[model samples]
Target: MKKKNIIITGTSRGIGYELVSLCTDAGHNVLALSRDAAPVSGLDIDNCACFSCDITDKRDVAKVSEFIKEKWNHVDVLINNSGYLVNKPFSKLKMSDFQDSYEVNVFGAVAMTQVVLPFMKKSSHVVNISSMGGVQGSAKFPGLAAYSSSKGAIITLTEVLAEEYKETGPSFNALALGAVQTEMLEEAFPGYKAPLSAKEMASYIMDFSLTGQNYYNGKILEVSASTP
Candidate 1:
C-alpha cells in the first residue's frame, strides 16, 4: 500500500488511540489530535505526530493548519473521530449540554475540515465519525437527546460538504457507528458489553478512511451489528 498522510481527531483513547498506532504500524504518516495528547504521544511511534487539540477551539485548529503547512503540505485522509457524549434524560437536559454536544460533534468537525481542505486533492478522503443513534429509524435509546441529535447533524453536514466539493476535490462521507467497547460507550451505557472492541472498529475505520471515497461520497453508512 502507498504511504499516505492522515489526520485523526480524538486520539487520546478508545478507537482514536488505537487508530494512531495502527496507521503508524502501516507506515502512514499520522497526525493525532486530542485534548490530551499524552496517550498518543507516549506511544513514540516513528511516523506519528501528536498535538493537544480541542477541536472547538480556533487556536488549536490553527495549530493543526500550521503543522500541516510547515510539515506535510498535503493530506490524504482526515478522520473526524472526536466526539462528546451527554447522557441525560431530555427533561433534565440543559442548553449547555446541547451546545457542548454540537460544538464538538458537529462544529468542531466543520472547523477541522475547513482548515484541511486547502491541502487535500481529489483522491483525498474525509471520514466523519457519527453514531448509529443518529441514523433515521435506527434503534432509539434514552439519554441521548443531545448526543444523537448532534451526530445526526454531522451526517447531514457530510452530505452537504461532499456536494459542495464534488467537482473540486476530496470526497466526504459519514460513518454511523454501532456500539464499540470504549470509554465513551461505558459512559452512555454503563456495564453494557459491545460486540466490537476498539481496535476491531479502528481497523475497519482505518481501511475505510483510506479507500471508502473511491466508491462512496455524500453518503451515510450505518456500520453496526448490534442495537445501541
Candidate 2:
C-alpha cells in the first residue's frame, strides 16, 4: 500500500478517531483535526499529529490548510468525517439547528475541499461521510430532519463536484452509512444495538478513502447491514 498523506476531521473520538488509529498503524502520515483544543489524551503515534480546528470556522480551516502546505505540501486523501446532529422533530427544530448542521455537515466539507484542493495531488480521494438517514427512501428517524437534510446536501455536492472535476482530478464520493455503534449513535438512540463498531466502520472508511476513486467516483454508496 502506498503511504499517503491523509487529513481526517473530527478525529477526537468515534469513527474519526478510529480512522486516525488505522492510518497511523498502516504507516501513513496523518494530520488529524479535532475541535478539541488539545491532542486526544494518550494518542501518541509518531506518524500522526493532531491539530485543533473546528470545521465550521473558515479561519481555523485556513490555518490547517496552511499547515498542510508547509508540512507535506500536498495531501493524498482527505476524509470529511466531521458531522453534527441536532435531533428534534421538524416542528420543534430551531433555525439555528439547521444552520449549525449545514455548517458542519455541508459547508465544512465544501470548505475543506476548496482549501485543500490546491494542495491535493491528482487522483486524490475525498470521502464524504454521510448518514443513511440522508438517503432518499431510507428508514427515517423522528427527530433528525436537520441532520438528514445536511447530509443529503453532501450527497448532491459529492456528485456535482465529482462530475465538475472529472478532468481536473481528485475523485469525490459520499458514503451514506447506517448506524454504527459510536458514541454519537448511542446519544442519538439510547441503548441501540448497532451492527457495526467504530473500528469496523473505520476499516471500511480506510478502504474507500484510499481506493474508491478507482470504482466509485461521483456516487452515493449506501453502506448498511440491513437487508432490503
Candidate 3:
C-alpha cells in the first residue's frame, strides 16, 4: 500500500491513541491532535506528529493548517474523532452543557472539515465519528440528551458534505459506533463492560477510513456488536 497522510483527533487516549500507532505501523504519516498531546507525543514515533489542538478553537485549527501546508501539502484521510460528552439528565442539563457539547462534538468536526477540505484530493476520505445513540429510532439513553443530539448533527453534516463534495472530491461518511470500553464510555455508563475494546474498534475504523469511500458515500454505517 502506498503511504498516505492522515490526521486524527482525540489522540490523548482510547481509540484515537490506538489509531496513531496503527497508522504509523502501516508506514503512513500521521498527525495526532488532542488538547492533551503529551501522551501521544511521548511515543516519539518518527512518522507521527503530535500537536495540542483544541478543535473548537480557531487559532488551534489554524495551526493545524499551517503544519499540513508546511509538511504534507495534501491530506489523504481525516478522522474527526474528537468528542465531548456530558452525562446529565435533560432536566438537570444546563444551557452551557448543550453549548459545550455542540461546540466540541459538532462544531469542532465542522471546523476541521472546512479547513482540511482544501488540502484533500478527489480520492481523499473524511470519516466522521458519531454515536449509535445519535441515530433516530435507535436505542435512546438518558443523560445523553446533549451528547447524543450533537452527534446527530454530525450525521447530518456528513451527509450534507458528501453531497456538496460529490462532484469535486473527498468523500464524507459517518460511523455510528456502539459502546466501546473507553474512558468516555465509563463516563456515560459507569462499570458497564462493553463488548469491544478501544483498540478493537480502532482497527475497524482505520481500515474503513482508508478504503470505505470506494464503496459508499454519504452513508451512516452502524459499527456495533450489541444494540444500546
Global lDDT scores for all candidate models: 0.95, 0.88, 0.95
* Cα lDDT of model 2 by residue, 1-228, tens digit: 989999999888889999988999999999999898355535878888777888888889999877886889889999999988887879999899999999999999999999989887667999999989888888887899999989999999999999988897899999999988988888877988889999999999998888998887899999998642
lDDT of 2 at 63: 92
Please list the Cα RMSD from the true structure of every candidate, rounded to 1 decimal place. 0.8, 1.3, 0.7
lDDT of candidate 1 over 1-228, digit per residue (tens): 999999999999999999999999999999999999999989888899987999999999999999999999999999999999989999999999999999999999999999999999999999999999998889878899999999999999999999999998799999999999999989877999999999999999999998999999999999897854
How far is 115's C-alpha from truth in model 1 (Å)? 0.3
Q: What 10-residue stretch in candidate 1 is worst by lDDT?
A: 219-228
Expressed as tens digits, the lDDT of each residue in 1-228 for candidate 3 is 899999999999999999999999999999999999999989999999988999999999999899988999999999999989889879999999999999999999999988999999999999999999899889998899999999999999999989999999899999999999999889777999999999999999999999998999999999999955
Model 3 scores worst on lDDT over the 10 consecutive residues at: 183-192
Give every collision pair in model 1.
Answer: none
Q: Model 3 segments beyond 4 Å from truth?
A: none
Q: Judge candidate 2 against the unseen true structure and give its global Cα lDDT, from 0 to 1.
A: 0.88
